[model samples]
Target: MKKEDEAKSRRSFLKKAGLGGLSLASFTGASAHIGDQIAYASQNVNRNSSPSDLKITDLRIAEIGGDVVFRTPIVRIYTNQGIVGHGDVRDGAAKEYALFLKSRLLGENPCNVERLFGIIKQFGHHGRQGGGVSGVEMALWDLAGKAYNVPVYQMLGGKYRDKVRVYCDTTVSKDPVEYANRMQARVDQGYTALKMDIGINLIKDIPGALINGHEADYNPYQHQSTKYNMTKHPFTRIQITEKGVDKLMEYLDVMRSKIGYDIPMGTDHWGHIGVNEAIKLARASERYNLAYMEDVIPWQYTDQWREITESSTTPTQTGEDIYRLEGGFEELIKTRAVDIVHPDPNTAGGILETKRIGDFASKHGIGFMHHHAAGPVSFLGCVHSAAATENFMWLEHHAVDKKDWENLVTGFDGPIVKDGYVTVPEKPGIGVELNEEVVKKYLVKGEKLFAPTPEWDKIRAWDRLWS
Candidate 1:
């Protein structure tokens, strides 16, 4: 009779509850079952999780640049959401920095850029090696930005400009007419600012004399001189003669004449000459009224930069090698060593960090220009930063001559440059996607494309420092 009564109770409960329904008290007793199902679903969600979820993904070297520069080996960080961010290690940095620092980043949320930056920075100091941390940090922000469906500039705060102006390196030309023609061609293409490489080394190989009666300066880096007496610039024996200065002045005049007076041109690669000589040459070139003289003295010479900026009407620009904004650029900014702060994104940490550097410069009333002699990854990174910065003067496009340069990256939905300006990508992350076809075509000899990095699996004892 009892068994029959219980069976009748179950039937009634099922009929009332519909799908596996029970009375209120019975439903309370089944709560554990529902909790078990919920827990099981949660586990399934985590099953496909990635390192980016934990915030740590190992980095591996992918060599991209070779005969073709856009093929730069950039670092990519994988995340749990299947989202990845690509970052460029500094141009020509040892691959070890990226490899070693990968261990330090394991299990951290890459979105926590400041936290990861502070932790991993203990592994890096400055110079080219900082490329590892800088690159990885860039990739993290890229990932974070994508995960949030925002641009990197938007992540920093907000953008000050929709499009960023770019400066291109002037093509080297031996013939005055050829150089002038090139300058005009750049103008025709709508480049607002251009930089010329003015070094006597290329002209040295010319028969008889490169510059009329002036003896070409024999730099040890370029020529082997038994008596390498390095005096300074004006008094220095390299190109001090009136003839040498005349040759340079003639080159400048040709550029100025061909481009007319509207262009903002700058000169660089003066070679290994002292500050005093550089100052005299700068003074001599006053007729062109250049926008700025770049690297007049090695960036290390703060006092010399101050002297150059003070003595010349032209604004002096330096700081491509500077590492951090506070320590590296503090002296230069505080003292007004250079009128502009030119930072290479690869060398200057990542986007947010570079923005910090730019903001600091603004406080000191200095202008900013980004230095990018790297591939698309670094260049795009600079684009995001320049868009966010307020005091920007111009960003550089080193490979403006190559039509294929912009094609190497897959993320640009539209034209990168339009009417002399580079428009910031509106898409999430950097708005660049890697062109696998281009990578295959330009891969360095035997390099593999996006291979698995299993070597970084186990953390070595040396990986942990504090514990």
Candidate 2:
């Protein structure tokens, strides 16, 4: 054909294909590519998914309290594409905390996780209050991963391990021998790491174990009032006497003898004692080579954490209640105040933020350990984070003895907790679906299962933190 005829045909095709406004300059140097562009436009298109549009359609919750003490609220985020993501509010947190986020998430793309998180993060606070936003963040990641056909860990820059190391909390006993036996049982069950509650209450009945008991009638083993729960570490005015330290030492000796030094054993629930006593107790237990003395003082006392970490041979860990990395864990990690950062994903800003926390701690030469007590939904979230984090030591499995714990969810290739490690799921999203039958069997009284939440569909206030 003549050059003029070819040019006329190209112009005719461009106009017919809805590219009529293309300037000659736009394709002036690409005349040779006109045939290729026309060929591309000839292909059939699946308009329904041509651009892969996905949107959050609804959010619901199921509050289930099994044989455990905690009533866990599991949140499900449903998308228009029929893919649903699961997340769990921190145990003991209200379902409304997560439902309240429906107004902020409706019609948003779950793939824009960081953008959505920024919009909703202000609603979260430290501890259980963080559960709502964190849970929603977790669900968003799950949805995003499913939409992209990748595991949650893969969404967090791939994973470091196929199986996550889990540490189970051993049942505590007042009798030292029984306590040792119980720890051995955990070891027998395939747990290589263990944690025990070593507190003054264990030896409080022993004469001269604790000093200054007359003032507050403090009881550490059982919950009393806000007086014991809310008091800062320094203001507790409670001290473990030399005899008390010896008693704790005896318990540790029994545990060490039973579990052996090869296994990493941690201690927690040391009561509301001040820093000095915490230091003393930590020093006293150094011989046992505990994994770390957790929450030696409160997590908020950065200086005190540094003091205990510097003064004792045992590594110190905190941050289970810390909400976000920037304001809550940055100072602690930057200052090296704690030897290990123990974040509960349910409270530490969900999966990605918790991974960020682990990455930050890794930079400071600190170890990362996860603290978890909820059901398998959040537990799997931690599993993915632990699999991705290089500095992760172990994840706490709070439901070691709960027979029905593994039944709450399905989709695992094998046992949820085998021996001691949890195999990270290769499936998309969180990799498990809630067992509705089992969940309903354990639902908290008066709580509905995935009930409609219309009240949270509209915003009612000015939520912007900045003017």
Candidate 3:
């Protein structure tokens, strides 16, 4: 009877072990994520774990004023360690993305960028969705960099340069004289490189007869009308005829004469026209010798970009919408489509990703330029990445006109930019913080923009899967 009882007890214990109760091959075959099961938990003891260990805290939106309004939703990641990572969602993107990603990131190590990005990317589509991912990634990297005691660029295989050149935007006035005066003002501020607006649509209503029935028309409501006309690319129907192209050339002539030949002038905001028209416009700008034709064609047309680059002496450039250097920039680099690769780190997956894009472009004998127009967080991020990137030509500073824009970020000792270049910060990570007072002054409706999330407080179906 004693021997029979001992055998029965052993059988019961083995049965209770479940997968451990099986043969080695059977156990391995039967278990999903066997390694994780074996590692995260020990059969020796049972400790209660809940998804709240990964609860999301909060999401807040802040608006900063500039030449253009930039409303950024900054995401804060709160961990058990009391360390928080700051992230910025792309301006004009839905705040929900930053919020949605917060759930996916709960309980995971923000330092594990590769894994987190993989999971978050499943929910991210193109365009604004891309911005949310990029912004969240920026914050994660910022947190990782702080935790690791390194600048974001150092994580990107190390720094390649110390100072990043900035490009100043010069707005065009309806009056050519006023436009010329604005161009001179940029030079007065010690800007060596300047980008000006030249939208033919702005002047479409002017009386000019085209031999090809190409007289420009105006309609503010209709996208095809004058106000909307400047929005087309070079390849589309609203393109300039030979005569119209001459008129544009005359404007460029006046601009070049004012800024002079020595200053490197760039062009942008040419509207959503198609690629063929883009080529014509680019070719026309050759007479004035522009540094590059920025966003001349729609960003998706890589073939057209290449054609324009090949046809015009001016380099073709695009990137503000691109999320990663590898996905969008790699294709352009392979084809030598653009003379320069411009990336907005906020939209281009933050510091490391932008640097990688720049490095890739450099390998192809192309220049790398950092695109701006986001908030202080993004601009600071750009400063760090551009400082470390080589083959960097110039970064954009669209809000230079805003006296309060630089003040939005704190902990930096002095003006970030002196002369025409932005100096790298010796401090850690992005090297700047938000001025609570300034943020409050500029925020819309006193929004509670950056609150801590309690990852341990929430339970969800999705959260249970990873744990």
lDDT of 1 by residue, 73-182 (tens): 67877764667778887877765677677666766687888988887765555668678878888888787777767788898888899889998866788787788788
Question: For model 3, what is the error of residue 261's alpha carbon versus the real structure, in angstroms, after optimal superposition?
Answer: 1.6
Worst 10 residues of 3 by lDDT: 46-55
Per-model CA lDDT versus the true structure:
0.74, 0.86, 0.69
At residue 3, what lDDT does model 3 achieve?
58
TM-score of 3: 0.78
lDDT of 3: 0.69
Model 2, runs deviating above 4 Å: 1-51, 214-226
Count clashing residue pairs in model 1: 14
The TM-score leader among the candidates is 2
- Candidate 1 ranges with C-alpha deviation above 4 Å: 1-54, 202-239, 457-467
Greater-lDDT candidate between 1 and 2: 2
Model 3 alpha-carbon drift over 4 Å, by segment: 1-69, 209-236, 451-467
lDDT of each residue in 1-467, candidate 3, tens digit only: 36576455444445645645544543443334445445433565523223234333343345444343476666666665555566677777766676666656666877777677777665544456677787777777766666666777787666667776788886667776678789889889888888888766555656551221234344333544454344444424554567767776777788877778999888887655667677778877888888888887767778878887888787788888787865677898888878888888777776777888988988889888888776777777887778777777888987777778777778877787777887776665677777778776766554665544444234354633353
Of the pair 2 and 3, which is ahead by lDDT? 2
